[model samples]
Target: MNAKPLKIGVIGCAGIAERRMLPALVADPDVEVTAIASRDGAKARQFTQRFGGDPVAGYDRLLERSDVDAVYVPLPPLLHAEWIERALRAGKHVLSEKPLAANGKDAAELVALAEDRNLTLLESFMFLTHSQHAYVCEQVVQGVIGELRTLTAEFAFPAKSADDMRYNPDTGGGALTDIGVYPIRTALMYLGSDIEVIGSWLHVDAARQVDVGGAALLGAPDGVTAHLTFGMEHAYRSQYALWGSSGRISVRWAYTPPPTHSAVIRIERQSHVEEVTLPPEDQFANVVRAFIARVRCGVPSGLEGESLLIQADLVDRVRARALIRPAR
Candidate 1:
């Protein structure tokens, strides 16, 4: 028996929705792009024209649509808490972009609200859904990495324009919240959520009070450690490595890869080095499917809430203790 596709509404017509998410949603048989909303009618229309959804003039209007079972919120960091609350209260499941809130306290509040409402709330850390990571976990569990000791990850790319929203502090613009969260969440994935912030460093645009880039040191009580570096001011890098007692595992493209990108995991042991190439996958589509499954099953609280709070806490810690370097 076939199930009806989950009818989805997209809030905020950001570039990511146009470039990555909408295409993935329309391609998935389990998802129906029911509506797409933007303040600019023309912008919403452009997305609907390419993606096969009805254009909505405003986010509030999209949320009111009973046809939408779930919504994907890709709005700016400052706008997340407000819109997510409204969507959940409207009885819609939410899948939001990362850094779900500006801090841990706010994130916990949102989690509690969703729990009380019995709604699914998930953060979009798309990399975790890729098959390559599952394979990495398999290797670690199989002793291929020989008792994982330390993990290091870095995810950075070129900087945005001066007037970009990423540079606006009020909009939750900063390298840490934007790019740094990737490696931080990756550490929480491998090292456990109990991970603590050892120390951090940030390059701040003093006048703007925006963190341009930074690195964080995280450690678990079990002696495992993860060093993460991320920023929008550097050349491209999307990778992480796990070092163990006997061998090491490295992924050349760990974080964000296009749907057609084949992920290569390299294992180096005392005897030899091997490269495992995974078939290309679209993690964006994978996450969308996962969201649909959760919505259909009416999964209760804690399916992904605990991790969201943990990630939010770590980001706050990094920002709190960062050794700031003024942007030049």
Candidate 2:
């Protein structure tokens, strides 16, 4: 609490911003929301009215302010690289929504730029900061799951509105980048980045020319493996599990649990099955605090830069190796 509060501005009032992100930023004592920008003046005004920040009609104007030391970008994936680079060049730290960019190239460039300028660049993988994940890791390490053999994850939801940007290819809309990264990043977390992509597949939405569903297989050196399935055209399933020799540990609502929702772990062994429920946590708020703490440390470049690069590279590799299947 001794460190000065970081003054931050937002680049867009996207739904994720309203529902999960902005609320957390506004509540954090170490973060000051200087402005909230939107292309629509009225929408910007509405967010400002609720969040107590200045209403900015344009994204660029918010970047020019002296009071702003950081920026939070909740824009589409295609726009991430552009604005992130601009914010860094403007001498402002950046926290962008997951995926970082549509490709690894842009992600690498942005990470290097942040390092060169000694700025904080974070990808908002809020779930990773939640206490539930750490607890899960602890359980795994404590031999509750025995010798880890496999990790599997599923993160998907039903179709969006007819006009949702996710159905459009131009916005970097696809199951892989939009939802698949949750499991892929989690895979890297447990399996390590050195894991190789064994096989993959992407089901393309014929009319939209974008991927709607897919799965990938990844293998690690120590006989551990990961199986990931993600989609935008399926029944809602946000969960992952770790299977060891003697038992398995699984989680429900793993990726996007509501703040009031408690963490639940389902464990299965040869003898019995049990459930372990932990306290509720708002991952969105926890991630914002982690970002604030990283900034306060005054480190030139944090682990986030490396995380972004590997995560993006893994995404690229999955796409390159995936077998194309038509949603006919």
User: Which one is best on lDDT?
Assistant: 2
TM-score of each: 0.96, 0.96
Whole-model Cα lDDT per candidate?
0.88, 0.89
Over 1-328, each residue of candidate 2 has an lDDT whose tens digit, in order, gives: 3877889999998999999999999899888999998999999999999997899989999999999999999998778888999999999999999778899998999989998998889989888877777788888899987999999999999988877878789986688989999999889888887989999999999889899999999999998999999998899999999999999999888999999998998999999999989999898888787788778875422238787798899999999999999965
Task: Report residue 32 deviation for candidate 1 (angstroms).
Answer: 1.5
* Model 1 RMSD in angstroms: 1.7
Which stretches of model 2 miss by more than 4 angstroms?
Answer: 298-303
Candidate 1 deviant stretches above 4 angstroms: 298-303
Report the lDDT tens digits of candidate 1 across residue range 163-228: 887889988669998889889888887888887788999999888889888998889999999999
